[model samples]
Structure formats: structure tokens, C-alpha cells
Target: MNEPGYAIRAEQLTKRFGDFIAVNEITFDVKQGEIYGFLGANGAGKTTAIRMLIGLLSPSSGIATVAGFDVYKETENIKRNIGYMSQRFSLYEDLTVKENIRFYGGVYGLSSSEIRDKTDFLLKKLELEHARNMLISSLPLGWKQKLAFSIAVIHDPKIVFLDEPTGGVDPITRRQFWNLIYEASSKGVTVFVTTHYMDESEYCDRVSIMVDGRIAALDTPRGLKRIFHASSMDEVFLKLARPEKVGDI
Candidate 1:
């Protein structure tokens, strides 16, 4: 059984696509109000695992609970308790910023008045009040990314999943996005994020590195560096990615 305080718990979670194994049996826990980073390279099964957690994809075998709801039985409860932002911006390109928020808020079942109030606050916080009426396609990439994140959490879910939220943006924009994530975490929103960028992993409270569909290591960034005897996550990743030598542990 999972402990009372964990926001997410998974035991031997596995996912298979026909003959190929996308995610091997992996187990981990994410605490409440934590910023947990899932780091892995392309084809490393990060997305497949995340999909299972968020109820987007069912696992082949295993037990998993997110926000205290079982992934297999109470998927609707999990969906209601969590928010998700994918790599592709989820907003409609033709809709204005405010309109996009309105649409998503409606889908989440928020009252019109509630949506309006939350939209106002988000626009101010994102400094997008001037562009509230601008079409989503007209906004800069950074602004779009920020807006997408804001909409994802507009209903104030207990947990939010960000999948490569800053994929192609500049360093400055990525830093700014991290600030938003930190703000959300401070407000007691648990953040579960996956990223290929090594530097971003440093911003997390704890990180899990996935290699070949399994979690190879899980620890705080500093602890991981100390254990691996590396100066940066890039080096740590390289060390883990290298082939094991003869007689190696």
C-alpha cells in the first residue's frame, strides 16, 4: 500500500506496445509539493511512463496511483486531480489568449465567472494583459509556452505534468518558465516534469534518470553529482549512458 503523504506512487509499472517494451517495470514515489524531474534521452520511455501516470495510456501490468486515485480503476478521479501540458502547445492557434483559456476552463467544468476571474489573474501574472485579445498564433513562442502552462493549471489541480515544456525556447525563456513552475510548486502544486535538458534537471527537488525503459538512478541533483563524482548532470548522464566495462559492478 502507498503511504498517506505521497502524491504519486507506482509499483512495477510496465507498458508494452505489441512486441516492443516502451516502459519496463519501474517504481517511484513523488511527494506532495515536490518538483520531480524525469530525465532521459529520446526513445528512453519517459513519455510512455508519463502517459500511464496521467491516465492517457494504460499500463500492461502494474499498480499505480496518482493523486491518491488508482490509474486502472479511478482514472477519471486521477484526471480530475491532475493537469497536463504536452510538448505541443495545446491552445487553438486561431483563438485569442482569453478565449483559449475560456475553452479549457469550460472543459474542466469551471463556472464562467470562475474562469473569467482566473483568466484575469493569469494574464496579469504572465504580463500578457496587452495580448489577451491577440490570437495564440500571434504570440511569441515564449509567451505561448507560458500561456499553455497557465491554462493547464487553470483549474488548480493537485498535480501538474509538464512534458518537455521548454523544448525549443531560448535559455532566457526557459529560465522564465522555470520561475513559473517554482511559483506553482510554492503554492503546493506538485510538479512532475520530463526533460532532456540536463541543466533544467538542476531546478528539481529530486530527479529520476531513465535509461532503456528503466529508472537507473533517483536522487537529488546534488546527491546524484556527488555519487557519480561528476561536475554536471551532463557528465552524470554520460557516465550512466556509457557501456559497462568488464569486471565493472
Candidate 2:
């Protein structure tokens, strides 16, 4: 059964590689339908923690759950309840837009009719009907990014994980991408995203900052600004995640 109110829960969740700890004991919970931002600098273990949470990597210690499925015991069920979009975008370049939608919809166990119906709806909603027959490779980066995200949640997953989804897009594209995110959130889909864009932090319902494989702060963007005594999320992130001067990793 799903957790009463939390979409994700972890108590002292940790991971280790040899003697080195990749994700030190971290505890947190994401409430249902919340936009939870996961932020960390390079080597801070945000990805490792996500890997363990999403069942790609086993945690070395502690307990965790996603969509009420135990990370240790119900990994397959967790996979079924969550959608994932990687930074590189997961569409096959050779596949037409319609083809990719059909492929992923089938992968999620939707029937032929369901896929067909959703494909039409998605194409129209994203204004991609004109491009539905075109190869994914021929689409602009923004189009591909939006298509990838739409495909990720085509099954209406309980949660969606976006890993640096807006990495190289222009400002307008990023704004458009976030509009989709807001629409999803309004529909009760939990969003767990990892991004370096400080401005994006303001959009999140709550944000967690990681430093040296440990979460140094977790709060609402406004709360974080107050706690860090800063004027913006950028200053808060810098104070907690970047203790060293520029040129330091």
C-alpha cells in the first residue's frame, strides 16, 4: 500500500564504495504531490542517493521507501510506480515521435487502444501533431526535452524523477519545460528533480541541499533563505554547498 502521505521516505539511508562512503546517512521524506528539489555539487552524492532510491543501486545501510514500496524489498514495484527522465533525454533518435510514444506506453503496460488514444492526446497537447511523423533526432532540443518528459509520465506515474532535465536549453525553453512540470504537479504528480539552476529552486515546494554526501539543509526556498540569512536561493546554496572559493569542486 502507498504511504499515508509521503511519496518517498528514507531514514539514515546510506551507500558505500569500498571504504569510501558515497552517500552518508541521509534522512528525508517527500510529501505526496510536492515538488522536491535535490541539489548537490559534483561528488556530493545526490546521484548516488537517487540511484539507491530508484532501485538502480543498493543502499549499504538504513531504510527507505518510494511510493510505499520498500527500497530493499519492493524495488520492482517502486519501478512500476515511478517515471524517470535522464539528463541526456531517453528518446531514440531513429524513432518517430509517435513511435517513441507507442514504445514507452507499451513498456508501461498500457494496452494498444490506450496507447493510441494517449498518443493522439499527447501530440495535440504538446503541439507536436505536426511533427508526430518526424524522427526524434530532427526535433529541436526543446522539443525533444518536452517529448522525453511527456513520455516519461505517459503512464501517469505516481512520481517522476528528472535529473538535470533543463541542462543546456535556452531560457525560454526552460520556462516552457517548467510549465509542464507545474501542470503535472497540479494533477497530483510528485516531482523529484536534481538541478544546478538556482532560480529553479524558487519553483520547488521544498529543497534539500547536499554537501559532502550529507544534506546540510532542507527547507522551503523562503525558509532556506531565512536560515542562511540570504536574499536568494543562490546565496543559500553557495553558503551551504560551496564552502570553498571558486575553482574548488
Residue 233, model 1: Cα distance from true site in angstroms: 0.7
Query: After superposition, which runs of candidate 1 have C-alpha atoms over 4 Å from their true positions?
Result: 244-249
Residue 175 of model 1, lDDT score: 94
Candidate 1's TM-score reads 0.96
Q: How many angstroms is residue 217 displaced in model 1 relative to the true structure, after the best TM-score fit? A: 0.4
After the best TM-score superposition of candidate 2, give how far the Cα of residue 49 lies from its true spot, in angstroms.
Answer: 1.0
Q: After superposition, how far is residue 100 of candidate 1 from its true place, in Å?
A: 0.3
**Model 1 local distance difference test score:** 0.93
lDDT of 2 at 72: 91
Score each candidate by Cα lDDT. 0.93, 0.93
lDDT score of residue 43 within candidate 2: 83
lDDT of 1 by residue, 93-144 (tens): 9999989999999999999999999999999999999998999999999999
Candidate 1 clashes: the total is 0
